[model samples]
Target: MKRSYGFLLTAMAFTLVTLVPVGDLPAQQATASSAALPFKWEELTAPNFIKAVELSGGTCIIPLGVIEKHGPHLPLGTDLIDVRAVVLRAAQTEYSIIFPEYYFSQIFEAKHQPGTIAYGERLIWDMLQNTCDEISRNGIKKIILVSGHGGNNSFLPFFCQAQLASRKDYAVYLFQPPNDPAFEAEVARMRKSKMEQHAGEGETSAILAVRPDLAHQEVATTQSGEDLKRLESMKGVYTGIWWYASFPNHYAGEGRYGSREIGEKELNHQAEQLVKVIREVKADKTVLELQKQFYDESAQPLKTRQ
Candidate 1:
């Protein structure tokens, strides 16, 4: 009988990670139990880290965000800040190791704007793949990728699909929260601005909830958030330049009506939705089992049933 190398490495990592003295940990996290260990990966001492792996049931989350210009009013790190807030709140209820401030992601559409850190296409692909692999190496077998930037919608799915290109001991799950009608109705009833998207009313409200100082509501209306109708006749067509053609300033929606109250509602909804996902992922076993089956068949398809 052959022993598996992956298992051996995982066991060794777990052993070493549990050796740190509890006294060496920060005062806030020093006496905390498995249930109380800090959710942020960097905040956990080695001993607590192992406990976290157990507490999370080998589950973790990468709250993905991007460094890009968010209109003229919001800070460049708006996406990163907002996403972190949501994931941190969710983790409090669900108990998963949360990766810190991951802003390296697809953002070519905002390259023309200031403070956009758009890594090369290949680098972005390799970086994300390597990050997931590293997470698995550290004993986390389930990874949840939750992105706050809307631009990553397409890129994340493609990345998840590519996991099948090789046999992986762990599984990657993307968190795509749906629009709850009740939540939407509540927002709509209070929303004064009809055109909020990026730095618009909704986004500004979210920021206000997280970092009210960073959201300059008064400056939000300095620039136009309305679409300029640059590609009207080519409605059915799609092109890379479509976003820039319409909203070159990268501003969308009116932010003047943003309120901390509205922001609180949106954040609560997002965090609640993510908590549900964390629970589901922790209980999921079929995905990894199916993945293993697929990998085994792919290795020798002739032996598989016809």
Candidate 2:
């Protein structure tokens, strides 16, 4: 399969430096039982990788994240950190090979903020496409995209749709967990802040629960996360600059009001939902079968049933 040249070079360089040859390990360690294998792709031995692919039934997850600045209180990698935490928890229940930290995602709106590593649109697209290609090449044909960053909300779905633009041996599935009314109502009752977006109460609480040492709730009140409503008049029209125009400080919602209890509850709920998704995707064959049928039809439209 074709891959991005730049990504290929980087991947080659990484493999050369970090990976030990399968033959280098002792015979016993190289042939260890699958029960001792780790779910993380990077953590698995070269030989164990094959076992993981088979154990997972060719299912693998790419927990997508972006390095963007959160509010003053939360770390720049809050989204990635939080999302991975949930993915890891779910993987513990439903085994799947988890990709390493992937922060190549859309973060153009947060470019104005410090510590935001917003790559060009083409680079991010190529990186993700090539990453998926590389994973599939390794025998894991069912790739699951579980995005932690809100910025990827649009990009991921579009990527999945674009897969149909051509024929692919592997299938790409995006994990979109539906909201549970009971959970939302519980969150509403626990939520102290009225506005909870970005590094707000919900996000802050999440960080506190996962990595309390990094969360600085005391400084959360240092910045204002309230919307400026700068472009309220253009309600019907959509513009790229809308996020920056409203939240110039790149901070939204009150983080000081976040609590660990709420964060733990939210994370558990998300993990539970993800566990279910992983199981469903593992058992699913219709998507790939349908894609094959669609591709064959697309190859010759005249032959398709009217």
Candidate 3:
């Protein structure tokens, strides 16, 4: 059953109170002058929210994740935990409004898993679109989507592309960090297992770094993480059941090999990269200008240049 928006909002508020520390005064009661403005959306008071939108140049970040099984040892919210950690760290360095826990994403493949929360396709789309619309309504003009879940790779890009289908006052930007060969080499040198996709060494290490208490490395070997190769014969064919066919256990790599050192290194590197991205996005004006120009041209296609 889909949770109501009211319930979700209330749940999110509760989550903020429990997970985020807002000092002596409650978040809503804290004055802007009392302390430094927090980057979290839920933590900002009504008055400070307006200041945050302006302070961030109408820029906001929605760190996307999903609720699903991540092997046997890692928690279901591993992606959310790690992504939020990275985004919060970056936002502190380069201020931006970080939206509260957003896990409503594509996770149909993991529906068979025990802890997977697979919202309907239509609902997920509407939820994201409405969220963006509401964010823009709140005076934010530039929205950045930083996704942590691998399943949202295709979904998020498609959503960004669909923003062009109709005219919008705000611009949406997807964060795609460029590859660093040096960092890749360092990771390769540190990791013992070469096969890693989900709940693997890299992912487990990430959880270890972010929330070591939640990571149970001792139970990592309880399930098989080996690829079943169920669809090996189907070459050049893309099937919806590919992931399930390949990794029936929903475990893809050797989590036993995960180390805290590798986890910290990866998280730090990602946060550093995100800090640069936020800085760049805050200074960028070309996207919005081009969006407006395109919207105008698109509306009158007959007058477009040949």
Candidate 4:
């Protein structure tokens, strides 16, 4: 299934090249700040949404997150809030119609903890399918999904791949923040702790930047966020209960190292990458056409033999 879907995406990649405009770069707006973006989908008037779609070239972003616990300091909706914040900033810079808060994602690991609203597997699949259908119905040709939750690492890819179960008029693109050694170095140098995963230094710093008032820096040490090493046998081999075994509290890492400076740097880098993807998606041409061709060919596979 992965291979077939990968092939479809590959085919779309080739097709998108032909459909999208590619050439000279435009003179960027030098003075514009990300603060200029429309904060909510409903904020745009009916007339403005039309203009928004045109400006975005029918491309839209769905910043995915989940409503779950983020250690002891961060908010339950931390991932949703932060992901949407970055998407909003990116859309402001690049002009894509942003979908509002989307917190429906995989979080079965956190179900035991408070405020963890993990949907069932069937519901998760249907929710995503309906979301894509609804977006396409709304005239968005390309949908970019950027997830802020690590728990969705598997689900998001599976969701994207399933788009090819049958052909559709639109496309789905999922991305993680691009790798940048310089950014990594910057984050490391800015960090006060060595291992900051989950509700730790990095997440804390990010929340500090976006919403500092919400950060409980002093109370971060109230709970031990370290791995209890409870599931010692599961380390060598993976299991479904690994997360529960290590951190039953659903908290990992210390938030003491969080700072606004690091948050700003990381977020800025993420927004920049999102903006770049927007530009590339806008210029892309082949995805739709190839999807059509592939759909046509799939009806008669015997004729596709070499």
lDDT top scorer:
3
For residues 162-278, what per-residue lDDT tens digits would candidate 1 score against the true structure?
999999999999998887898798899999987766888888888777777677777777888888888888967789888888888888888888888998788878989998998
Q: Is candidate 2 or candidate 3 better by lDDT?
A: 3
The per-residue C-alpha lDDT of model 3 at residue 253 equals 100
Clashing pairs in 4: 15-286, 16-285, 16-286, 16-287, 19-285, 20-284, 20-285
lDDT tens digits, residues 230-255, model 3? 99999998989999999988999999
Listed per model in order, the count of residue pairs whose N, CA or C atoms clash below 3 Å is 1, 0, 0, 7
lDDT of 2 by residue, 1-306 (tens): 221343224323333122222333334323432355576898889987887777666889999888988988888998888888888777766667899989999999999889999999999999998998999889988999998888887888999999999999899999898879988998899888898778999998888777777788888889889999999999799898998888988888999999889988998899899988887887788999999999999999999999
- Sort by lDDT, top down from the best: 3, 2, 1, 4
Writing each residue's lDDT as its tens digit, candidate 4 over 1-306 gives 111232223322331121122233232222222123343555667765665565566787888899888888788988976787677666655667778778889999998889899999999889888888888887778988999999999898988878777988899888665689987997788788888669888888788877776778887888878888877865478888888877876778879878888887877789889988887877778877788888888888888767
**Which runs in model 3 stand beyond 4 Å of their true positions?**
1-35
lDDT of 1 at 257: 81
The window of 10 residues in a row where model 2 has the poorest summed lDDT is 15-24
C-alpha lDDT values of all predictions: 0.81, 0.82, 0.83, 0.75
For model 1 the TM-score comes to 0.88
Answer with 3 or 4, whichever has the higher lDDT: 3
**How well does candidate 2 score on lDDT at residue 67?**
91
